[model samples]
Target: MSLSKLLTVCVIAISLNSTAAEHSRTIDIDSKVVSNHRATINGERINYSVTSGTQPVWNEEGEPTATLYYNYYKKDKVDDISKRPLLISFNGGPGSASVWMHIAYTGPRILKIDDEGYPMQPYGMKDNPHSVLDVADIVFVNPVKTGYSRILPNKDGKMPSADEQKAQFFGVNADIKYLADWINTFITRNNRSLSPKFLIGESYGTVRVSGLAKELQQAHWWFLNGVVLVSPTDIGIKRDGPVKAANRLPYFAATAWHHKALPTQLQQKDLNEVLAEVEAFTINQYLPALAKGAFISPSEQQEIAQRVAHYSGLSKAFVMRSNLDVSNNAFWKELLRDKGYILGRLDSRYLGIDKKETGDKPDYYPELSAWLHAFTPAINHYLREELNYKTDIQYKMLANVYPWDRSKNNTGEQLREAMAENPYLNVLVQAGYYDGATNYFDAKYTMWQLDPSGKMRDRLSFKGYRSGHMMYLRKEDLKTSNDDLREFIKASLKSQTHSAKY
Candidate 1:
């Protein structure tokens, strides 16, 4: 071969090798600086800056291992970070992105939805009237595998192994480890270490908070002032236990009344009144009948089944078929079978049209579907148009991170432990009565189990909303919940006596 031709072939081979070894740049850790903007909250005009990018996750050796995508809002001109309150928030999907909390409720602008939470046309966002930004600086965290976050290569220049990814951030323990570290680093880097810090978690986000709280205390020693849990799931609740069914009964009753599935007489009463009756029936009659299990006499079981049907708005025959235990899916499907609409599991108020109305389960949850359709598009638009983030990666609304190890998932117990460890740390649990997924009663059961002796129980608080899982989607619930949350933050910070065994 000629010398020129040989040289050309060698250069071509070198180019191919370089291209083959190259990977996409996963995280720009130094992209900390962001754009500043302003918005009106309540009657106050607040200037805020939005940082929408990825933050680096490092190993103990200070080696970058993963990237955590985040969208943070900081109230400007607060010269001293300690004087203001800082809230680090995320949504629960286990696989979910933080967009639910970011665009739906807490952010400056929110997707427009009706009082019933049904999406409206034109698919745009408006200034959030109930935004909590006026009071607290918010940081929305999208855990690894959600949103634009992904497991990055280590400092050794080797890509992440599946085992390393799972060991670092996929399961309960690992998620807490990295998230707790992310939060600590975020606060410290922003010069907000002395700032009153709080965690606001929705859905599985609450589960993350439970474990993350304890991790924050033990690993980082970064004490939190308070935590707000929306739709909590107690860790280690036996999935097959009677408690899960019993906890669901009240929610069924509430949903039945909403859809007029209950007896006509029960429908005539106010919501609180109807729920009061349902709560009574669940605890007084249904619970004991379920507890009896096979020991329940056939005659008494018939009577209890009839009573459950009356409260739950299902037929006596259908209730009996469930063997005195009606799962949420069955109830949602059966409640309006004749109406040709299946109820949503998350928010039973929203109705779905199943392909065939007789299915044992719904094809889709209408309420979550509505929220997803509305928010997903709005966020995609906002992230690029408003936040000025430039990325072509497919943003994850919910990533399927499977084989989620549940062994380390002891969220309720962890919350109790954190409370025990930090006497001043308070917890505010907010639940939606219409939420069938994480029933309010189940949350009550879990929170009750937090402190058996009721010694530090005073640190815990509970409030119910008129909406579903994403309570703020409803107009009235948004106002009420935000007001409640504002006062909660105040009370938690105000009560920092530094000696409160209270």
Candidate 2:
């Protein structure tokens, strides 16, 4: 569907939902399990059923508050459902849908995009050659206010107030608790309680799962076998803090190198070599100088400024003008200012016109700003058409589910806690080198911070891709990442088996 048509449909959907609300019927959710469907992935045929619907979320007093929507694909003919490992997946938006990681990445049918992940002409779905469905049953979940999920209004068919909404499902800890309940409910309802469980989260979803792992175990005694984090962003996305600029330096270096905007010497070397030098400089020189604030000498400051400009694609004067406090957003604008174009925040490979190039930050993120054009519609098509599920509720691809509470929800600490609590639990950290959002080095730093003792370190694995946030959209990265995920699951399952024997 075209953008205009999709918007029209959304208008219709909202009208229909509003009309339906007039009837004031109590929400009684029944899992809408669709019939089995067949797909050929990895050159092999597999049969799976799609369950697309919402689960009514109620308060402790049994008052309906919200409806959490989810999509699931379970492999058919598994001799023992208990032995079949289940992977529950979600994408992080606090307001974004699960579609990014669902139809775009791990689902049996993936949306067809260009070689570099741009929307393809005659956009449609196809069997994912690299889908991990051959190995595990997957559930793609959308939290309240995202995808088909929504907050249930009062008996008068009116939406709840903002504070009431947050009280039910908006804040960090609030989100984890409800999601944990939904997971357990799904497991119990599907009779897969014995299945080894895994979690797959992308971007902010990583933060969600990190805290979720601990919440599941601590609150419900639900232990997860493993976790797969794509473009991990455990720490918050703030960029103006003391060390934040320094933390973002490696990413700037990577983006500059990818765009060939760096100095000739750095550009000529391999990306890893360039990254190694930048990492050393970030830790040894840049960070210390930045830490000095106004105490450092001009000569030393000039030295730092020169090297920062050399590594980053910005001018020395520009770098020094900001007192060496350059951020990822500034780099995005400055690096491509001369070209009258803006580079993408998620992937520097994508370019967009910035209206006029006189700005500190890019006019918009080309990669995600135009996402609604393709991704939103594609997901709506897949859900209503292919899955045989019908819904008139306008799917919330992304909403302003704010003010997003960025409290002391240290999810990295939660991840470490889960690992410590569940010895059998392992983790797979996957990062995209070109992912300007959750840079590779920051992910490394998060993992390093998690494993201070190195004993649980062996269980932690890492993989870096040449793509961006939704790395699997890249054809090669898709295949390679699926292969990696297959191996990781196998190793984790084996590790679980070994731990069982002991």
Candidate 3:
């Protein structure tokens, strides 16, 4: 009856039946004309190639409806089949491809970051000595309509709108089903079913993983060993309801203030202690103050405004004028307006000058966008030349394909239920302290929602980095994150061992 015992039973059941009713098919590659590229990173030579091909998808009637195109990557080792753990990675635009993750974090390739965090010249690829693939097999997947994954024409043969394309192949449930089929087929073809499977998702991909986790379990009957969610966005936080969403603005403010982007006085205190006070104020006092409206009196309002200004590094008058309900967008644009600069919402440390003498929005975060070209080109070349893959498919590095649907389900509750239903499921949620988009505090709040019983709670691990959402971009942060991930994976594998003994 204990949670650990329950989890042990579930793991036993899953391991016993994992391969039941499993089927596989072979995929042949014609490599005669494919171009290959090779790169040396940290003294290790790795190869890859690009292959374009058609993948089959079944229709509603259980018949092959159409063939979808996709680009797949394999490391230097060919047909090694050592029962290595497998990692499947993707970006979150619902329309976005797997470019960032492929090049930056766990892929065999990486984009070079300059001294000031800007992507430098001579944009090229390098062997990622730090890639997690060194421990597991890596496969970056681009969903339909993103990253060369395209569906053949219907009977009428017409191109579909973005919305229509998503409705057909990019919704929550639809994506899970499609990936289940694609991954199952890929694993079957490559003969990796015995390998432990894991998924790594960022931004919107975090949302996708939440739904996919359940679908993969209930619908596909595949129990994942673990999942890593980076910069997660909880639907509950994004929605409007009676549930009081935790205020994340102060944590983001503290990060910006620490980097000297805010003011001098507030920078004097210990960051962790300051952040704790701000968090307490935001949750206990600020929420109620905002809810009371005009009845709270001007003096009380002034006190609240002063606290917001102190924690957020904004002017007291400005906070008071706004009535304390400033949204993320307003905060970004207003925070540094006096200095003729704006900070990136994704990574607050990056600063951008106003393009015109005066403009509402900052010019752009060149530091972040500039890395796309560097990584995309290198990944494409590495996959083709080093991996010995030959294909004509265009790699979709990033796309905004799938948008979050607020109506369909209780996203938070669903994840909690899945964890509760399968107590053995362990999670590693990583957050960048400087990330305003999906604040680290929000991630903590989301994790707190998981069944509070010791079994599920103990399986969960949370880590906060002193960087942005793309924490790996910073060398020091990247090193720390990589080590943390390695430890977490080891812990999960050990958990399986404990289950076996049970």
What 10-residue stretch in candidate 2 is worst by lDDT?
22-31
lDDT by residue for model 1 (1-502), tens: 9999999999999999887656444446545548788888877899999988788888888887777889889888877778689889989879999998798788888887777788988787888867788889999999988988877666666877777677877887888888988888887888888888899898888889888788898988888889888988765444456777777878888888888778888888887887777777777877878888999999999998888888888899988999989988888888899989898878878888988976788888888778887988888888888888877667899998876766757777787788888877889889888898888878777777778879887888999887788888888988888888888888888876556564
Tens digits of per-residue lDDT for model 3, 1-502: 9999999999988876765523212122222223344655335566754444545665666544434444444455656554456677767766777777767776656777663346766766665666654456667776765655556555565655667656667676666667767666666766777767677788877777777677777776666777788888873444232123236556557665656655566577666666777778877888778778778888888888887777787788877766776666556677777776677777877766766635445567644665664676676776566555445656666555546444564545556656666645678999888887778887777777655565567767889877777878777766677777766666666666555221
Q: Write the per-residue lDDT of candidate 2 for residues 1-502, one digit (tens) a residue.
A: 9999999999999999998886544332544848578988778899889888778777777777787788889888999988898999989876888988788788888887877788866777888877889889999988887887777777677888888777667778788888888888888888988988999888888988988999999988888999888888854433345567787788888888888899898899998898889999998999889989999899999999999999888899999999999877788888978878778988887888877889888877889865566687788888888887776667888877898776877777788888888887889989888778888777877777687888888889889888788888788898988999988988888875456321
Model 1: runs farther than 4 Å from truth? 1-25, 237-240, 497-502
Estimated TM-score for each candidate: 0.93, 0.91, 0.81
TM-score quality measure for candidate 2 = 0.91
Candidate lDDT scores, in order, read 0.83, 0.83, 0.66
Off by over 4 Å in 3: 1-54, 60-83, 155-164, 235-246, 261-265, 355-368, 388-393, 400-406, 452-455, 500-502
lDDT assessment of candidate 1: 0.83
Residue 356 lDDT (model 2): 80
Descending-TM-score candidate ranking:
1, 2, 3
Count of clashes, each model: 2, 1, 28
**CA lDDT of 497 in candidate 2?**
48
In model 3, what lDDT does residue 293 have?
Answer: 71
